[model samples]
Target chain A: DARVTQTPRHKVTEMGQEVTMRCQPILGHNTVFWYRQTMMQGLELLAYFRNRAPLDDSGMPKDRFSAEMPDATLATLKIQPSEPRDSAVYFCASGPDRGTSPLHFGNGTRLTVT
Target chain B: QQQVKQSPQSLIVQKGGISIINCAYENTAFDYFPWYQQFPGKGPALLIAIRPDVSEKKEGRFTISFNKSAKQFSLHIMDSQPGDSATYFCAASGWAGGTSYGKLTFGQGTILTVHP
Candidate 1:
């Protein structure tokens, strides 16, 4: 079965350091989504792209967090000068198209900032 | 209007029993409701989904009961087993290219422990 692949299954860094997470969506999937999961907040959509075009990123902290789809297959989420509160499991999900297919999520990158 | 509230942060059920999880949405525009199941160290997977067109949808032992008028939904797991222990989340999203389109608003989640 096809699955969304995310690199760096786990990350630990010091505060004020930069951290990057990468995801490779399933083939032929048009939509890619980035979500953050924490015990308190659960799952929150950070950003998403459709056909390589960014649709929404209102849920992300623009100051430090940035998400981009360099190509249809590659999506990256970077956090500059990370903070302790930024620790959470970041997930990448992909689907065929808007309202056409179900989103398949990756195992997620668990981030921890010291 | 984008929040989906879930009840009973945790639940315990015996094997061969029933497990119920409820969710309420504030957005009237939300037309698609899906329930996701997640085990430790894994991503959430779509278990079942339902639309407002049907009040109830059943697939094997998993069922979704939706109330359009009340803007609420519930997931029922019958004949539960120990393997069913995981975190469940109820998500709601609207279609038709609205602001909430393609964006799922998930509830806080419920931890279910099925004892054998």
Candidate 2:
């Protein structure tokens, strides 16, 4: 079974450092989503893409967060000047199409800032 | 801000019992509803899904009961097993044009524990 793969299963960085997480979506999947998971807020969608193009990123913090799909297989999310409050698990999910399609998720990268 | 609302932050059930979780959505434009199952440290997997055209859809031991009029849907796990224990999330999506083929809105998750 094809799976969504995320890099750096765990990450720890300083509050002012930069953090970049990568995702390799399942082959043939056309859509990708970035979400943040915290104990208090559950899961929140930060951004999403389709066919390597961004669709909606309104959920993301425009100041420091960016999501991109350089190619069909690669999707990346970057956070600059990470804050302690940014500590959470970042998840990447991909799907073929909307409507009846289902998303396949990765193990997620656990980010912790001090 | 919460377009989708899910109840029972957590649930506990014995083996062989039926496990049920419910969800309601405010967006009437939502045409597709899906339930995802997530294990610790793992990604959420699609368990079952339903469309507004139908009231129910089933796969193996999992079944989705959807009530379009009420804008509500639920998952029922028949003869639940300990292995079925996990966090379940209910989500909704609408078909969008172009690269944005689908846009999803998710609900707060519900944790289910099946005791053996």
TM-score of each candidate structure, all chains considered together:
0.97, 0.95
lDDT of 2 at A38: 88
Candidate maximizing lDDT? 1
lDDT of 1 by residue, A35-109 (tens): 999998999999999888888999999999999999888999999989999999999998887563588999999
Pairs clashing within candidate 1: none
> What is the C-alpha lDDT profile of model 1 across B12-42, one tens digit per residue?
9999999999999998978889999999999
- DockQ result, candidate 1: 0.67
The candidate 1 chain A region of ten consecutive residues with least summed lDDT is: A94-103
User: How well does chain A score by TM in each candidate?
Assistant: 0.97, 0.97
RMSD in Å for all candidates? 1.1, 1.6
- Please report how far candidate 1 places residue B66 from its true position, in Å: 0.4
**TM-score, B chain alone, candidates in order:** 0.95, 0.93
